[model samples]
Target: MTSVNDQTQIEQETGNTEGESKDSVKQEKEMKPEESNANSPTELSKLTKIVKHSKPEQPLGFDGFKKQYYRYASKFGTTLNLLVVGGSSLGKTTFVNSLIQGSLTGKKTAKTSDFMQHRLRMTDGDINFNLTILDTPGFGEKCDNSNCWKPLANILVQRLNAYFENEIKACRQLPIVDTRIHGCLFFINPTGHMLDPLELYVMKRIDRFVNIIPVIAKADMLTPEECARFKRNIIKDLQHEHIQFFHEPGKSIEGINYGMPEPFALIGATKGMQSDSKNAIRGREYPWGVINIDDPQHSDFCAFRNFLLYTHAEALIEKTHKVIYDALRTERLNKLKSQPNGFYTSSKKLVEEYMKAELGRVERSLRQTVQDKLQEKENLLAYTEKQLEAKHKEYEESLINRCNELKSQKQSLENLVRSDKTKKHSIFFK
Candidate 1:
């Protein structure tokens, strides 16, 4: 009996030993994987498995982007960013107000102080583009015993520089001056045949920046022959100054006159009228004729708009891009100039060093700027997506509610129909 009992105890002990061994093996198996993972190089562990199974996200096509751009651009199209700059009292504001057929008493004139900007839209047509006319305070205005050209030029340069930098930087902080400045409509008085010294100075400054379109504003003050002669003289002067102008193809140099054609319209405070009646006079003796822009049939403003649309569209777009680039370069030069004392003792040496260092710096800066902008865009897109999702959710909820209401109405109608059928059957039976 004792032998049998000891044998049983040994068997029980063996079974217990086997069970403990199995548990140890299972624990080790689990620990081995964890140990291996922990021992593995971090980078090696991070190597993503190339599962060639997922579909790629589709990208928007060029046409899609263009369609999107066009949608936004359509809203901005009529808003022509026109900077009317010339010598004082040349009727910059007058011409602007006249174009939009608005009074210069409060809103228009008040908006224009020292370099005022006003957005004007045509009340006549839905097809008309919005015009944002920037009436720069008349250059050469007398202020505190000084001609304002120097200060104005300085201000203009600064503004130009800022505009250029913002464009290049694509800086969202600055107001976008629609890099598409269609035309610089330079207002000149026909009476003042010769360019004033200040005018000459302004013209030279303008030549550096934009494609100047000289418009003799008070055209009614001159005869057709006199207007032609004046245009020729002005063109000659501009050419002498080495200014290149965009002239219509096949249009001869003699025929290449600035400003829109025919019965030049003018807006007065009281009434507007066009004078097509030929002035029976010579150069200075021509009557100053005025025309209301309200008369769309005879309005020179319409001609101006038409000219911009058909003839100068390409020139304007091209000029805008050039202006943006020029502005950026000028700003960069100004920044370099404004650097602290002895920053560039020898320009040549500094330039060499800058050349060596700047390419890398610019590359890095560009990368960073692009990344920031892209991230911002991405954030905006994400926000927009969330908004859309919320809208969709709300719409879905509303649809569900409407469907429930419809279902309830349907049930009620069915109940009514059944009740009516039962009553008719009962009546028939009776």
Candidate 2:
């Protein structure tokens, strides 16, 4: 009885504990609505602040990456890499200085026979983006232009390899620095002729790796008729050679169309022209009049500048990533995979072995299939033969039984006629 009473006390204590827990849960449920209602105004205020362009105390969406990039760019700025390839005295540096509106290079710059890098730190409106220039000097000046493009090619491949290396790594604490060039401004000399050997070689060498925009330098030196004829010849040559350039074939940028789809024939603006107007502009002052660089009748300088800086600036960088870098990445990966489709042969010996093994396996599978078919046919034939024999035996037994029954009937007739003593033997025989 004492034990029973103790069990009853234990049950009562557990029931009371469960009841207390349920009561506590109900209280929490009732208070949760009030708590949420009290904080609802704060949430609404946070949302209103976000709408007014102020950051919310809590993140409400996934613009974090964009914000991070904006912060990073505002702090350290971004880079736009460009390469300029042309002959000497083509006003490459002069054109750049005029474009930048300041002296990024020296006045009396020494003639460099090698590749040179120039940088300009300037604000493009509100954005602070640095411009990097790779200028190739002594291009056609050298007597032997045989391997002049090798240095440029090597540099391009080196940058691509660096990027690919950083991409394929398992883990990286820091982001990869994009040193790949965005575009190559190929300056073609206005000699009223087709593309030259050095120009073709250089353009073709780095065309697959980088974006190139051909510029016809010194358009003021050529007559209007000569320039038109020159552009036609260049177009014919480019089509004949099957060379791919930066933009789509037969397509021009909207509102930024230069003189032609390729080779914007524009005169490089002479920096600091002393014109009649009080304000100084980048142009040439002649005895007759001053020719403005931005004048469409004079050159396509303004249009080209608008396209390069304002219109297609981001497109240039994106093509470097999506088209050129993606192509490189695919090629590298395919070479590593060793595909046997004849496009790329990464490991010749391994591909051969793999194909040989596949062929052997396929042959064995076909052989097994033929064997299985033959075995199934043989089984059906044996079954048919057995059925045919059984049918023959059954027919033979029925015929024999019929013959025996006929003989027995004949004997019965003979016995009946012999017992009758009046039956004739001839009748029985008949």
The number of the candidate with the highest lDDT is: 2
What overall lDDT, based on C-alpha atoms, would model 1 receive against the true structure? Answer: 0.54
Error of 2 at 123 (Å): 3.1
lDDT of 1 by residue, 1-430 (tens): 2233343354354332233333322221223343456655553332322112111233323347667766665555544466677666666777766655555342324434676667755533324456666677666556541334344434334455545445555346644655334566777766635545556656665455555667766665565577667777776777687764534444424564434322233322322333456532111112454444444442345556555654555556566556544654664667667988614323334334544563476568779999999999999999999999999999999999999999999999999999999999999999
C-alpha root-mean-square deviation, each candidate: 38.1, 25.9
**CA lDDT of each prediction against the hidden true structure:** 0.54, 0.69
* TM-score, candidate number 1: 0.46
The residue pairs found clashing in candidate 2 are none
Candidate 2: worst 10 consecutive residues by lDDT?
A: 46-55
lDDT of 2 by residue, 62-99 (tens): 54667777777777666778888777777776666566
Kindly report which residue stretches of model 1 are placed more than 4 angstroms away from their true locations once superposed. 1-72, 75-79, 104-113, 121-130, 140-147, 167-182, 244-300, 309-314, 327-430
Give the best candidate by TM-score.
2
TM-score per candidate:
0.46, 0.57
Worst 10 residues of 1 by lDDT: 47-56
